[model samples]
Target: MGFCEVVEGRHSIRAFQERDVEDASLEAILRAARRAPSAGNLQAYRVAVARASSVRRLLAQAALDQGFVAQAPVVLVFLADAAASAVKYGRRGETLYATQDATIACAYAQLAAANAGLGSCWIGAFHEDKVRAALGVEEPLRPVALLPLGYPAEVPRMTPRRSLAEMVLDIREDA
Candidate 1:
């Protein structure tokens, strides 16, 4: 599918079918994420893929009882590897660039899933500490986003968006 189509076709899917997502599909998503740009080529990010029922259950609870997180066949938890960023860029890398890199990767993964005819929801409403504990992650790796991926059971109606004029500002200094 075309890039515009991929972007336009995607919706925040909260309901998923009982079918399992193919491994190849997940691999494609990972590939897209891996290509995301990062500060200083550090690629300071890690993804925790949860496929087991017990683990997904814990993730769902950590995601503030967003049950769809557990219902989906897989949940990918994006983590910011702060120490990796800090090694080169120092405090700013740890405090900002690492998180920015992880979020970009998550966005790429979400788009890749949509392009593959898969459904995904960007889940950010969760307790950070709970997420770390659920995923058994230690320090320097912070969970930044949760992505629940699966086949959509319900395709929601398109929501409205702001016009370019309303959303953007032309700062051309010719004024």
Candidate 2:
């Protein structure tokens, strides 16, 4: 599919089939994420892949009772390593760059999943404390997003979106 098709095809899938996602496919998705542009190439983010039943259960709790998280074949937890960038670039790195890096990576992963005929949802409504405990993450590393991946069971209708004219601004001033 073309890029526009892929963009149109991508949706936030909430229901998934029981089919398991292969390791190779998961790696391909990660590769796409790695291709994302990072601030100064620091790439101060890490992703934790969780597929085990027990771990998925805990992740479901971390996601605030979102059972689909447990049902998906793969759950990718995107982490922001503030200290990694802070060490090199200091305070602004911690405040902005790390989160940007993580979010961009997650976006790449989502597009890659769509291209691979897999479905995905970017989850952000979870409790941070629960995610830390469930994933055994140490201090200063924050969970930026939770992504669930698998074959979609239900095809969702397109959600409403604003047009570019409404969302974008042209700053050119007439002389």
Candidate 3:
């Protein structure tokens, strides 16, 4: 499908098939994430893949009892490596750029998963400390998003979206 169709067809998938995601498909998703544009090309992000049941259970608890977090065959934790970017761009990199880099990478991964005929859910609601502890993430690396990926068991309806006229604005000085 084209990019527009991909975007329009994609939705958060909470129910997934029991099968594991293929290694090649997972690699493609990760590769797409790496290709995402980063601030200064610093790639100030890291991804933690959790496939073990124990780890997924811990992540589910960290994610405020979101059972679906553990239901998928794989869970990807996207981490913002602030220290890596801060070395070059200082405070702004640490505070903003790294977070943006991680978020954009996650977005790319989601799109890639969708394009590959797989399903994924972007989970942002979680306890940061618990997530870090669950994934053994350390200081200077902050968990930004948790993505659960697999073949979907249920199809989600398209959620409503705001129109461009309502969401955008243009300004000019002259009439």
- Specify the highest-TM-score model's number: 1
TM, every model: 0.97, 0.96, 0.96
> Global lDDT of each model?
0.95, 0.92, 0.95
Off by over 4 Å in 3: 172-175
Candidate 1 ranges with C-alpha deviation above 4 Å: none
- In angstroms, the error of model 1 at 108 is 0.4
Per-residue C-alpha lDDT of model 3 across residues 139-166, encoded as one tens digit per residue:
8899999999999999786799999889
lDDT tens digits by residue: candidate 2, 62-121? 899999999998899999999998988899889889999999999999999999999999
lDDT of 1 by residue, 1-175 (tens): 9999999999999999989999999999999999999998899999999999898999999989999999999999999999999999999999999999999999999999999999999999999998999888888899999999999999666889999999998898976
- Show model 2 residue runs off by greater than 4 Å: none
Worst 10 residues of 3 by lDDT: 166-175
